[model samples]
Every structure is written in C-alpha cells, then in structure tokens.
Target chain A: MTSSSVPKRSRSAMDASAAATQALYGASDPGLRIRSIVFRSALLLSMTVALIAIIGIISWAVVEGGQRLSLGLLTNNPSSFRPETAGYRPAILGSFQIIAGVIALIIPLGVGAALYLEQFANKQRWYNRAIELNIQNLAGVPSIVFGILGLAFIVRGPLDMGFIAAAGSATIALLVLPTVILASREAIKAVPPSLLEGAMALGVTRWQAVWKMVLPAAAPGMLTGIILAVARAIGEAAPLLLVGAATFVTFDPNFWEGGYSALPVMIYQYAGRPQDEFHVLAAAGVLVMLGLVVVVNSVAVWLRAKYERTW
Target chain B: MKELGKEKLMAESASTKEEVFSLDGVNVYYGDSLAVKDVSFPIYKNEITSLIGPSGCGKSTILRSLNRMNDLIPGARVEGDLQYHGADIYGSDIDPVQVRKIIGMVFQKPNPFPKSIYENVAFGPQTLGMKGNLDDIVEEALVGAALWDEVKDRLKDNAFGMSGGQQQRLCIARTIAVKPDVILMDEPCSALDPVSTYKIEDLMMKLKEDYTIVIVTHNMQQAARVADKTAFFTVSSNDEEGSRTGVLVEFDETGKIFSNPADQRTQDYVTGRFG
Candidate 1:
C-alpha cells in the first residue's frame, strides 16, 4: 500500500505546483505567460494606433486652421482668387438644408421600415429574409453608388427633379437609410418582449402596443442611429459631387432648385487648389464639419442619457 | 344599495354560479406540432381555478388560450370550442382585441411600462377610453390590488423604482384598471420571494371575490392554498420520434384533488411520488 501511494502522492504534489503556477500567472503552462503578455501588448498597441490617428487628425486640423478660423470664414462666400476673403456661408446654409432634408426623409422611412421588418414581417418567409439581407448589404455599398442612383433617377429619370439641393439630400438620405434602418431594427429588437405582451394583454391593438411601448423604449437607440447617419451624410463628398453639388456658389440655394455647395464639396475644391491660403481654408472647413458632427453626436448622447430606460 | 348587494350575494351563494368559460375538446398547436391535447373544463364566475403540472405540460398554454394570448405567437392555432359566455372565441367575427378587453392576463414576470407608477396603472384605462374620474379609477384599482397603500406616496415615481413584488402588484392594478371580467395569471409569483408570494396569494384570494381567476403554477402547494378547483396536467410522450403532448389527467375540487385524487398520475404528482 505504501508503494502504491508513493506515485499518487507525487501526482498530487505536481497538481499543487500547477495550482501555484496558475495563481501567480493565471495559467498552468509557464510558456503561456510570455504568450499572454505578447497578446495583450499587441491588442493595446492596435487600440493605441487608432486613438493616435484620431487625435493626430483633430490636432492637425485645429493647428492648421486656427489662424484662418474667424467670423469672416463663417460670413463670406467662396472665392477662388481671393482665398482670404472667401468663406463657407453658402456652403454652410446649403449643408444645413441638405441635413434637414435628409433627417426629414430618413426618420419616418427608416423607422417605418425597421418597425415593419422587426415587428410585423413574417421572418420565415423567403421574401422577408431576402429583404433583410439586402438592407444589410445596402448599408455596406459605396455612397457613390447611391449618388449615381439619385442622379439617374431623381435628377434625370422618371421623377425628373433637377440637379438641385433636394436631389443631393435625397441621395444622402438613400445612402444612410440602410444604416438608420439596421440600427433602428436592432433598437426595436432590444426592447423586452414582455413589455409588448403586457401592453397587448391590456386589449390594445398591435399597432397601439408598438406605438406606445416599443417605440418609446427604442427611441434613444434610434436617435443614436440617426445621429451617426447624419454624421456620415455630412462628410460624404463623392456622392454629393455625383448628385451635382456645385464646387463654387456665391448665393444661398433654394431648396428644390438652383446650384448648391456643401461644406465637404467646398473643402474638396479648396484642398485641390494650388495656394497656401486655400489649403488653410480647406482645413478650416474640415474643422467646421468636424465640429458640427461632434455637436450632433453630443446631442444624441444627451438624448439617450435623458431617456434611458432600465428595463 | 348595501342590502340589495347582500341579498344578491346570498342568492348567488344559494344557486350554482355561472360559468365564465367552458372548453370542449380543445387542442392547441404551434404550427404542425401539438402542445396541448384534448383539454376540457369549465371555469365558474368569481372562483379561482389553478392549473398545475410538471414542466413541459402546457399549463400556461391552456391558460393563455382562454384570453386569446396565443394569437400573438406566429403559427399558433387552437382547434375545438373555447367558449366565453356561450360564444365561441374562435368564431369568424370575434375580435381577439375585443376578447382581451374582457379577459386580462398577467405573465410569469412582472412587466410594468417604464413610465411612472401613475402612468402604468392609467395606460389601459386611457387607451380603452374608460370614462370616469381618472385619479379615482387608478386609486380604486390600486386599492383593489392591495398596492395603493405602498405606492400612494410615490405615485409619480417610475414603476421600475418599486421592488419586484410591488411591480407585480402594479401589473395586477394595471389589469384591473380596465375592469376585465376574468384574470389569467401564469405563474405570477414564480419570480417572487416566499413572502412576496404569500402577499400575492392573499391578494388573489381577495380578487376572486370580484373577478374569475385562472392561474397556472408549478407549485402544487400554491394551488392547494388559493385554488377552489385544480387541474393536473402531465406530459405524454410518443415513443415514435419523441414528440411530447400535454394531457390533462385529472381535474376536481381542490380538496378532493389534493386528498383523494381520482387518477394515479394525480395522486403521484400530489403525493410527491413522481411528477
């Protein structure tokens, strides 16, 4: 019996050593220590790189544009020859109009689509699945593709609206609709099914239940989606170019007609110009665009916090 | 009016109470699979009927069917007659929403709207256009659910601020706000602590004096304590392909079902021999 127990005693001793090792380094294998350190360092390095890039861009824009940023930049109109005198007045107004139009278009349409897909559609049906898959794919498609579609359809084809600010708004709205829908659908799905059931049990119609309970529960998340979409819409230059966003405009744009210049389009034109003053102007425009996006996102975050529901 | 009320109560006690619901050969199916098979029973007005069974026995399914709650589930269909006041609930002209207005339900988990306590109780009445002094109606409903005393001071607070049991009672108050004739509870106390469960049990006993109550519970003791009648359900599985169906084995007055059950399965279940 002593001989038999000797090997068992050694095995237990080995287990104790393994336990000691795990307690020290979180793993039994000593080699895993180096591996875990290396893995952790790599992950940290990757995140640091992203953080550095964002900070560098913001700093560079502020430093480059700080001197040129002024009330004049906000008040004057774009001029190719007189870069110092030029401002983004028309572009600012036009961009605001486009954003407003995009919001008006996307909120109802995207939320409606999300509600129908998440709450009403029969998911087992092939067509519904196809529609869902297509929406996801559409969100990933290049914004330029949407611009082309808007140009061909809204500006030139059956609808035959002109190359107007509203046309650009339509294009951007179409570009971001998938993003809004996907996000809104996720928000709607996050609502506990119990809330809907409780409301329905009270004899309310299905629409009433969704309208009263699900929508309120989902409003915060939906607002976040809209804000992100708006940020994406405001920064897009290529799409607006395709939809005829004018590179140069001295006058404020009418909504449905006339030439319009957006901040991104103006920045693109200014940055391409062969002059130091124009380059500074481009940086200033970029800073303004970034500021607007930050403001919109801040508002979204505030709204989410204000309406956060625990359940 | 007080004398008239007493006289009516005496008459109602002397005569057999009216049946609120009578099920005849009911089989509930989700898509092609049967969940509950051949359930037949009568639920009398102003009495508590508890459906008790082991897991997967479809007690909740039978309770939900009474108020057409199963209609919310896609591909769920019920065959055979489930009558409310002698009218078939499955008839072509019968609206599920209208049916729900008369027969309210509480779920296993308490689900109050993320609104104020006042709003949570007021929602159903507001939506259904229940005309009265709104505050009075809310207070009366809360009082009836035995929650007014605890919640009256914090009526404007968020419903989620309440403890679990209070939230459950708030749900009960919300249901009563609409003045439903019958209330279906599916394991309302399962999520509560023992003390909270006792409180809800006491509340349900009081509720049965006004509204007919049907409860589905896993706790046999709970059924014995608060139920006037008991239905024991058990899972019946077919050997071929391992399909399971919930079958009602026995149903009787609570006393007889607990003390001297007619079926062997009921005796086994009640005596703790086997589920």
Candidate 2:
C-alpha cells in the first residue's frame, strides 16, 4: 500500500503543483465545506439582524405616526401636542437652513485648516504640536459643553445673534469643524508627495501643484468627511437646545432672525415630555431624522467609490 | 561616417560645456559630517559624463549638488564654488526651482506621475505655461526619447503600466520636454533590463547632441560604454562619526580611466580592487 500510494501521490503532486495548490483550497477542497458554511452563515446572520432592526423601526414608526406622516408633517409647524394636527414643516426647513450655513462656513475654513496643518505647517516643531493637540482635544469635547459656549457667546454675548437659524448654524459648525479638519487632513496626507513634486518639476508653482494634483486627489475623501461631519451636525440637539430651538413654530424662521427648530431639537423637546403620545411622536421623528442622515451619507459613500484612486 | 557640423556643435556652446559646470574645492556636508570632500571636476557641454563609485560613496550627492537637489535636505550645506554657465549656482538670487527647470533631473527610480503618457510629457511645458500647439511639443518629446512609436497609439494610457525601461524613457522625455540645458540622471538604468538599458544608452548618445548628460552609475562597464568622460569616486575615510565620503580619484576620457589611470586608487578601483 505504501509503494502504491507513494507513486500515485508523487504523480498527482507533480501534475497539480501550481493549479491544485490554490484550487484545492478554493473550490476543490472537501475539508473547507464546514468552514465555508460557517463563514456564509455568520455573514447572513449579521445582515439579517441589521435588516430586522430596520424593518422593526419602520413598522413601529408607521404605526405610531400614521396620521402625521403626510404633507402636514412636511408643512405644518411643530406642536406641543395636538397629535394628528401638529406638523414638523418649520423644523424641517429650519434644519435645512442651518445646514446650508454650516456647509458655507466649514468648506473653506475646514479645508484651509487641513491644508495648513498637513502641507505647510512643520510637524517637527512645538507650535505645530500645540495646534495638533488642540484639534484632537476639540474633537472629544462634549456637545453639551459646546452648547453652553454657544449660549454664552452666540445667543447673548458679543455675537448676540439670538436663537436664529444662522446662530444655530454657527454653533453646529463649531461642533463639527474639528472633525472636518481632521478628516480633510487625512485625505490630503494620503495624496502622494511624488505627484506634487512631479507637477512642481514641470514648472508649475507649489500652489498649482497642490491645486491641480494634490487637492483633486483628495477631493473625494474630503467630500465624504464633509458629509459625515454635516450629518453629525444635523443630528445635534444639546448645542441647539442652549442656543435657541423652539418647541412650536408654524412658520420657517429666516436665517438671521427669529427662533429655529431642527429635527433633533424638536425630537428632544417631544421625547422629554411625559405623555405617551409625545414619545410615539419622538420615535417617528427619529425615523425621519435617520432617513436624512442615510441619504446624505449614501451620497458620500457613492462619491468615495466613484473617484477612488486606482494608482 | 557622419562628419561633425557646426549644428552638432551648436548645443555644445555653454562655454562651460567644454568646461560648462566647474566644481572647484567643493565640499558637501550633511549636518556636521561631510559627504563629499575636495571634489573638483568639469562637465563639458553636450557630453555624457558618468560618475562611477561604490554604493553610499556620495556619487549621487555630487550629481544632486549640480542642480541643488541637496537644498531640499535640512542641515545640508556645501562649501566651495559651483559655477553654472560661469555664474555662481549657490548665489542668494538663484531660485532652486529656476535652477531645477534649467537643469532637469531624472531619479534612479522611474517615478512617472499617475497620469497618461501624453500628460506626463506635457507636464513640463504646462508648468511653464507654454502656449500654442502643445501637441507638437508632446510628440517631439516622445520622439526624442524614442518612445513615440511604442506609446503613440496608447498615449492616453496610464504610464505606470509600462515596463521599467519605457517608464525611464518617459521620464527622460519629461526632462527633455522643458528643453533643459543639462540633464542629471541618478542611475537611470539600474532598474531596467539589459535590452532596455541598451535602448537608454543609445538614447543618451543621441541626446548628447542636444543636452549635456551627467549621470551617476554603479556599472563600470556601462560607464565605459556610454560616457565620453568618466569620474571615479571612492570611499576614503573609515569611521562612524567621521565616515568616509566619496572622493574624485580620477576624471578623464572613459577609456583612459579604465585602461591607464594615473592614480593608484583609481587604477585599483577601475580593475576591481577595494572599491
């Protein structure tokens, strides 16, 4: 048996040296059956659990918000409690207005800070170290702490902008600026230095190299970071609570004046109430809030895949 | 046999080319440690001059200093005068970028941008904001590097997909696109196969009719084949804190340096002694 097996084994081994060595572990191996089953089963289980959670939330929200999910939810102002009669129209518009201002403020400032830190600033010195340290510390600072600061500075003090949409946007921008700067820096740092030098070698100045090669390479990444930071700002309530978010508003407030109410601020106001009806409203508001976040983040993920550098 | 004409000598008129770049009493230092010491040589115009030395002997450093690539490194300093076109290259008014544009360099590694073949050639002219008929310039550069026919149809394709030799040629095309007066290459053929190396060597011979080519190479045979004048550099001082740097032991006609070098050190190195 040994002699018979040795000859057959050697013959098969020689014949299948390169091909079966890989194929055997892939489609040819019988031993991997159980492992494959387990691997696929685990993957299915995670996806199934996620789907179940999503379906459960949607069903619950629809059941509780059946009467309020119509054009009224999109058109009417927030209410203290009239159940089917109250609407989130003002809050929706206010949230969008705040987001616009936040985007306007963060795009230039965040990208500028990122470029300064990643490209121009010398990393080997104390001043740069201090700047890096401060940014990291700011990222972890509590949202409520930022709210109190916004209250003191923006709502009342020198900035005395009231609880206007612009004021809320400013507060949220400050809250998300650290995140945007950090993400933009990571994206910029990922751009190959060789590309920059290649451009500069051609006779293009340092600014042109960055504008033409480095920044474009980093664009898709920066866009994703902006989306995530914007999404986070959209969902913030603690900062908005102190600055000036009202529980009820029939009409959308203009940017610079009057009270504003974002989805989170409205959700918080409803959820904190003792009524069971208000709690149901809060859950429904959560679904609407989550939908907005998903849409924005989906666009970001799409853009990331679109321009993903192959080289 | 092709006779030498005034046009063939037209590019050789850097005055300093017959003596174009002169390094007199040049000492290169990286922080307090000297990397190259007492190196004196002349790079004639429109000639291929190769610096051959052992690895880490600072052969590349001398090449880099010619274009002030050393200025990029902190704590890197040079003592002694390096004159280009009979003017001080180390002068306060001389911008490194302008110097680099005039004296282009090709690294030992083939570093093509993640761009198309045509774009790679167009990069230099684009940087200089050269107007009108860029298509002509790109085509000329590709033809000059002898890569036009091979890459002509696929000029829009990414440059990274090409073979190492082709990529090196592309880099040469890039350097030449700007019409630099001198081209410094740091072991441009080290990463290429033999066939590719021959192609590049042939290209260098042709290019010498237009631009001065200064190269640093580890291949003694390559130097003998391609270079008109060869400078032999060797490691001399031996210690940690004061490690030996590359010294120019001999600089003459390539055949003379290989056959009848005057200095014993140069002879020992040329014949493969303690290189």
Structural similarity to truth (TM-score) of each candidate = 0.93, 0.83
Worst 10 residues of 1 chain A by lDDT: A1-10
Please give the DockQ score of every candidate, comma-separated: 0.71, 0.41
Q: Over 4 Å off in model 2, which ranges? A: A1-71, A156-158, B1-17, B31-33, B236-244, B262-275
The candidate that wins on lDDT is: 1
Q: Which pairs of residues collide in model 1?
A: none
Quote the positional error of residue A148 for candidate 1 in Å.
0.5
For residues A216-277, what per-residue lDDT tens digits would candidate 1 score against the true structure? 89989999999989988889888899887954889988888889989999999999999999
Compose the digit string of candidate 1's lDDT tens values, residues B11-116.
Answer: 3434467877899899999999999999998998899999999999999999999989999898899999998777788888778897787789999999999999
Backbone collision tally, model 2: 5
lDDT, residue A284, model 1: 91
Q: What is the lDDT of candidate 2?
A: 0.84
**Model 1 ranges with Cα > 4 A deviation:** A1-29, B1-14
DockQ of 2: 0.41
